[model samples]
Target chain A: MARVARGDRAAFAEVFRHFAPRVKAYLVKSGAVPALAEDCMQDVMATVWRKAAQFDPARASLAAWIFTIARNRRIDLLRRERRPEAEDLAWGPQAAPEAAEALALQQDAARLARALSDLPEAQRQVIVQAYFGDLSHAQIAARTGLPLGTIKSRTKLALDRLRHAMGRE
Target chain B: MTPRPAPRHHPDAALLMAHAAGTLPEAFSLVVATHVSLCDTCRVELAAHEETGGALLEMMAEGGSGRHEAAMDQDGVLEKVLERAQALPEAAPPAPPAPGTDLPEPLAAYVGGGMDAIPWRRVGGGIRQAVLETGPDASARLLYIPGGRAVPDHGHRGLELTLVLSGAFSDSEDRFGPGDLELATPELEHTPVAEPGAPCICLAATDAPLRFTGLLPRLAQRLMGI
Candidate 1:
């Protein structure tokens, strides 16, 4: 990311190679046609390169940050509206996150991946649909046999665990 | 940064997750963005949700859950993206918001400035409002109430999020001060009255039009577009 921010095409190309396919898959799952997804995927990668300076590893992982960009682009294309973003918290020089903290966050991310895969197939499917499929909570409940309360509790439990892992709880 | 008390109420986990996933409607997103701007606790929670999204994206990539590999021409797409990138200048860092603005950045962008800049229209009683332009899926508005004045009792058909930007308001539930968010679902109906102090200013978003119980308020709702 630092290299990309410095306008290194090599670094940007490496990121594109790794994430382009995944972003395409996400768009497809969200109901974009393959051709549309491919076009949008290109736009998303271009954005990743252009917005590299805004990427803060302390606040989000590269994959997470890219996910947000792709998500925002999808909303613009599909919904025809810009999604409102939260105000940027002012980060002073003295407030730079510790190297150890960033490392811990990455490790927790790995744990979260493992935890997600370990979830029951039904639970995981609903979660995947919620994010990539663009289904609302109510829609997810209605589509699946699971009750609304069950779906909410399942996601809530995952969020609680993530908060604990992030050391925010 | 001035230290304000953390918000006592927040959007539920589902709403935060939707926002992180970028699936929330524009009106709801506005409320969430403005609330998260003021509340660090919800900011951390939102980050957690985004992290979850990151993990899911990684998992999908590793698992190759879709047929994208068969259909996508990776090298061809990369060439196109590189071409586009060459023409595009890198984005500059966002400038800091003007000092002493009463509204958060997202809301301020919608309002064009702070409290003084709002083009409030009278919505009857001592309350005024300015409906913000969002997508058809939902609506967002800024509301101003004189100190101790009461907004009409209303119920929501869908979700309604009220975020206090300045001063305070009290409903049947509790007092909502600056940065505090109150989420009203269809099941709850209450009248919110501004607390005695400065006039209360709030940014409110509702997925469905509010259902006012009073006959006169219902007529006002038609004319006022509330």
Candidate 2:
């Protein structure tokens, strides 16, 4: 990402190439149009090029860095349902950019993935079903035959353990 | 001595799982973003979610379905980008606004900019929303329409939490001022009205969108246009 901060077009291009499809996949899964997904994909990549310098490793990994960007982009787009605001997605005046932290982010992503995969299957399933399957808590309760309180408690504890395992304080 | 009470409720398991799986509604996602901004416990949960998402992406790739993680595209993307860069013009990008001219701290810390400077749209009278903002620290932020108005009565399909930052609002249960945090389960129901003469300014983060009650209220909400 630092390569991005230094106006490295090649690095910026690399960021785009890697994230675009997944961004597209994410948007599509999130119910985005192919066209809208493409558009948001463009926006996400544009941010990478423009705000590459803001990637901070001490605090976040590159995947987390980019995920945050994607999350904000998704939010900006959704808020549009309520109001049509400006297009302030520029390389603007306020940026605590983390462009130099890509390598660290990559390392973090690897560690994080391992930690998540290592979680107890039951706890991991609860997280996956709720998130990937988009199940409501009541629905999860009904589906698993677990009490609502138990499901909730299990999910929270699972997440807590996952976070600790990931080494994020 | 015991540690100070955490300023905000961390995003619980359901919310984190939903976020990791990318199934969280946008409205709720905004609220979650606000919470993660104020709480570290939630951030750790988020880190785990990202990790989970990364592994799923990797597995898909190894199987040859071609999804190289949510934000990282290793094979095809790298090649395409390399080609795109060689043809671009030369010149390093400029630094961000020089020191002393930076955006105000909280706003900068939140969406990385001040409120007045954000691009806002009027959602209704005295109501405007800036949607989603990426914070300096990689958290998410949103610009709520302020200057006093009611928070349309609603409940979540999941737990919802809000952290007051600049103003006040009250639900059937309590009144909340700046720095105060409110946590509501899916079962709670109430109307959120702005305090008279002062618009409620809050930094809200949630795990799902509102499931506004009743057909009449839902219809009325649609009619009110927000």
Candidate 3:
């Protein structure tokens, strides 16, 4: 990222080679078709190259930042495809998180990963569908054959536990 | 239930999860993003969700091969990015607003300037509102109510998200100060009254017109198109 921020072409190439496929796969797993996922991957890489200046290692890990960009871009792209009239407010300039809080989050990725895997199967399944499969609670309820209230409660409980275990208590 | 602290009054985990998933409507996303900009707790939780997403991506055993050979550049995407980066004009980020104005970051772009600059129109009973058009199926607005005043008693026809931006207000739910988001559903009915000491300002979004019980307010609501 330091090299890419400095406009090192070789570094940029390395980043694309490493992250593009994974980003595309993330999108695909989240429900984007292959072609759309590839398109999003390219866009995500382009954003990475452009916003490299804003990447502060103290605020977020490289993977987190890259995936954040990818996830946001996926939402924007999907919204446009579904409702072209609906403009994207998500990508617009907003408050940067407090440096201290971001620093805390930056250190907790590994712990969070472990916590997620430790979640109960039902809780983890709902989260997986919500975060990666792009499924809303109602949709998850439909797909999983659970009641809407049950799905919402599962999600709330899962997040409560994850936030607690991640030490954001 | 005891009134939870401001951090406790966040948007539901379901809403945040939908935001992480990128499936929330733009109007609702605007409210959530603005609330997030103001709330550290939500920011940390959102970051955790993003990290979970990153972990899931990394955990995938089989990385799919390129199926869009034609759409993908035969040469490389890096070249295209570099070229585009060079071609693009430099973005000069706007100067940050001075602290304590109580304006959240996400709402700044829509306001063009600060809160004082907004062209607020009188709705009725010392309440003023500036409706923000955030695409379809929803409506967002900046509402200003004098201290000790109350909005009309009403029930939601659809979802209504009322996020207190400055000062405080108490509804049927509880007291909400700056950065607190109250999700008012159709089944609930309440009147939000500004707390004493200072005028309460809030960013409120609704999917459908509020169902006002009084005939006069309903007529006035029609006149105001709120």
Query: TM-score of B chain for each model?
Result: 0.92, 0.50, 0.82
Give per-residue CA lDDT, model 3, range B1-226, as digits (tens): 1123545588877777676566666677778888887666787666566677776665554445644663365346667666766655664443444454435556765776578777799987888998875667578889999999998888988888988878899987899887789999889999999998799999888878889989987986886676
Alpha-carbon shift of residue B192 in model 3 (angstroms): 1.2
Q: Per-prediction fnat values?
A: 0.73, 0.15, 0.35
List ranges where model 1 is wrong by over 4 Å: A94-97, A145-147, A161-169, B61-72
Candidate 2 residue lDDT tens string, A21-134: 666666554456666765675666666665666555645666555665665576557434221111122344655645455456667677667766788888877765664344
- What DockQ results do all the predictions give, each relative to the true complex? 0.68, 0.17, 0.31
Q: How large is the interface RMSD of candidate 2?
A: 7.4
Kindly report, for each predicted structure in the order presented, the TM-score of its chain A compared with the true chain A.
Answer: 0.86, 0.67, 0.76
TM-score of the A chain in candidate 2: the value is: 0.67
Per-residue lDDT of model 1, residues B54-114, tens digit only: 8888876533444455446667767789888777775778877678887888988888888
Ordered list by lDDT, greatest first: 1, 3, 2
- Candidate 3 regions exceeding 4 Å error are A29-33, A81-107, B1-8, B60-75, B91-102, B196-198, B224-226
Q: What is the lDDT of every predicted structure here?
A: 0.84, 0.57, 0.74
Task: For model 3, name the residue pairs that clash.
Answer: none
Q: After superposition, how far is residue A82 of candidate 3 from its true place, in Å?
A: 14
